[model samples]
Target: MKIVIISPLWERTPPRKYGGTERIVYALTEGLVKEGHDVTLFATGDSVTSAKLMSVYPRSLYTDGVSWSNAYWPSINISKAIEYSRKIKADIIHSHSQYYGYVFSPLSPIPMLHTHHGTLKSQSIGKEKQATLDYFKKANYISISRSQREPMPYLNWVGNVYNGIDVDSFYFNARKGQYLLWMGRFTPKKGSKEAIIIANKTKRKLILAGKIEKNNRNDYNFYKKEIKPLIDNKNICYVGEVSQGKKVQLYKNALCLLNTIKWDEPFGLIPMEANACGTPVISFAEGALNETIKNGHNGFLIKPNNLNGMIKSLKDIDKIDRLTCRKWVEDKFSVSRMVTDYIKVYQKFVKK
Candidate 1:
């Protein structure tokens, strides 16, 4: 099948610092390519992928010093992507962004699918551009989690396919445990404060790994004032922006992964990643946490923002079978599974 993937212009297909959507896009593209599918990726020029690459933005919009022009001109680039898809005779166009591809999705000659990666919270819920949502309904809609699909009732609920990763790349070491690892953006919604409280409660050495967006200064201030003071005594470490190598090491050597997300998380990739590395995740029961973390199976999911519960839950997390954790990922959350599901979706539409 000739598949064309439309990625968000903000970052590379596999982002440098903080990009969940980009990582998923890159993983899916690579998985599809490995499965003998003809894949064409439409993303920023900086995005590196095994598939044929087409650039819409000159540089990644999420770059450190990028200007507003990088954000504004992406639509123009997307228009070109649509034209390119038609010329190349793409059999299907799968978009990861919500609004950017709506203009082209309706008029495209081939079947299209849009996967919503982020949660549709209260703020962005009712206020979503009506015309854009209308345009989205023209094509099949893939929700990353059922929690994400709650707000958009009008969209065609084709399936809820979770994002996946390369389990082998995670590098699980069965006999390593030093510090508790918190992996995610240092945003309030992600629950860094809650993680800190849990760390303090448990009296465990904690390592906070992720980037703090410069634009959200208030969130940065909260991190500085609230989360920083707890960093002393060698009990907590704040290591900003970890690489793939460091991420694997962090997960492999951790006592457990901390994910205390407050919002309706679309899908917590870190939990599965931790599980793959033989480290269990102790996260709040929200969004995909209820779906992915099986209470006491691969990881433990406690009450929402219950710091004490999360801290207490850590003791039982060890009981989860590490090999079973790896097998669970292989059975459910592997990139191969995601690619197979997407191929089924593509074939469904193309056959009709």
Candidate 2:
């Protein structure tokens, strides 16, 4: 089947540093191509993919230091994708862009599937809420997790497909190294501050690695007031946004990954990545972490915002077998499995 994947303009496919959505899109595109399907990736010019790549922008908006007000790019990108789909008589157009798919789905003659990568509560606010209600029925939506769909149960959802990763790329280390890990955006919702608290409480060496874009004042302020003060370099080390190689090393070596997210994260890739590395994750029971972390099996899932729970889980982290963590991802979150599941979704809408 011929498939076109629409990626966000902010980052390249399989972003060098920090981009969850783009990474998932890259994995999905590669997986489909590996399975002998003809795939075309609609992304930034710099995006690297095995499939044919179509782009409107020279590079990622953020990477090129482009201003955020240049919002016309998304429309242009979507238009290009729509035109390409019609020209090629594509079997399906799978969109990872949050809003564009819904906006243009009705205009397209071919079947379109959109993977909802974010929380509905955040997206469905004022005018966006009305727009969603208006155009939701025209598009087929796929949730990243069952928990993500709870906020908008009324939407026309096809199914839930969990985000997946390339397990082979992530090397597994059965023998874990010293120090804990906290990797994500340096934001309040991500609970970087809480990770510091947990690290201090448990007296474990914690390595914090993630991006803090220059435009995000709130993240900068949060880093200064909440995270920076506590960094001792020995206990809590702040390693700014890491490359894929560094990320693999961190995950493979860390004792466990701390996912102290305070918000309803749509779907976290870090936890699954950690699992792929034979590393366990200690996450709060919020959003998709509930499904991602298997208590006492691969990792422990504590109650949200419960510091004591985090402290206690750390004590029992040794009980989690490293091989179990690796096996869990192999069984459930491999890229091959994700591709097979998505192919089933595509076959449902493809013309026989």
Candidate 3:
């Protein structure tokens, strides 16, 4: 099958650091290519991929300090991908650009598959409501988790393929390090501030690795106001955004990954990546974490914002065997499995 993957423009496919959607796009594109399918990845020019590469920008928008909320660049990215797919008479145009990409699906010359990589909130009755999804109902949609579809279950639901990672490449360590890990973008909904409180309460050394996008005023001010003062290099170390190799090292050594997310995020790659590195995750039982985390198995799940539970769980973090964590990810969230599942979704479209 010939497929064109429309990647999020904010970061390069398989991002240099701290990106999830593009990383999955890279994995999917590579997996399909390995399966002997013709794949065209529409991403930044800098994106390195085995598939045929197409791009609207020379480099990732975020690396150039472009704000994620700016829809202009992404629309251009989507247009380029759609136009190319039409020209090539592609079998499927797989989009990972959330709502922005789907809005342009009406112009698609072939079957379009859209995967939701980010969470959606209510927009009264317009933006994220049924009307919005209804506009692009012709496109087949895939959800990363069952819970992620709750906000708009009425959309043309097809399959729920969990986002996956390459488990074999991740470094696994049984001898855990002394510190805890908190990795993600600095946003109020991500609960980075809450992770700090949990680390402090548990008296564990904390390492925070993620980016603070200067273009996003609210997030930049949030880091300054809530996350900055809390980071004391000695106790709460802020290592900033980490490369893939550095992230694997951090994940393998950390006692556990702290994911105190406050929102019902669509899906998070952090927990799966952490588990693949043989490190457990202690996260709030919200969104896909409910399905990802198994208490007393790989990691413990605490009620959202429950400081005491999170602190207590952090103390018992060692009880969870590191091997079990790695095994869980290898079994359920492998990239091979994700590719197979996606093939099934695409086959359905092909039969039509």
Clashing pairs in 1: none
Best by lDDT: 2
Per-candidate TM-score against the hidden true structure:
0.93, 0.96, 0.96
lDDT of 3 at 94: 90
Between prediction 1 and prediction 2, the one with superior TM-score is 2
In candidate 2, residue 191 scores what lDDT?
89
Model-by-model lDDT, in order?
0.80, 0.88, 0.87
Winner by TM-score between candidate 3 and candidate 1: 3
Tens digit of per-residue lDDT, candidate 1, span 1-352: 9888888877777987678888999999999999998999988888899999988566777675554334355677667667877888888888886666666677777777888876766564455455567656756788887777777677887777888888888887777586888888877888887877777777788889988766667777877787777777478888878888888889888878888888888888888888888887888898878888887888888888677787778877678777777778888999988888888878888787
Query: What is the per-residue lDDT of model 2 for residues 179-259, given as tens digits with 9 covering 90 to 100?
Result: 999999988889898998888888889999998866677778888887888988888998889999999999999999999
Q: Give the TM-score of candidate 3.
A: 0.96
Cα error, candidate 2, residue 264 (Å): 1.2
Q: Kindly provide the TM-score of model 1 when superposed on the true structure, using C-alpha atoms.
A: 0.93
Candidate 3 per-residue lDDT over residues 1-352, each given as its tens digit = 9899999888888899978888999999999999999999988999999999988898989878887668998898888888888888888889998788778877777888899876655642346445657777766789999998887787787899998898888989999888989999999988899888878877788999998978889999999999999988999999989999999999998988999898886788998999999999988999889998888899998888897998877668789999999999989999999999999999998888
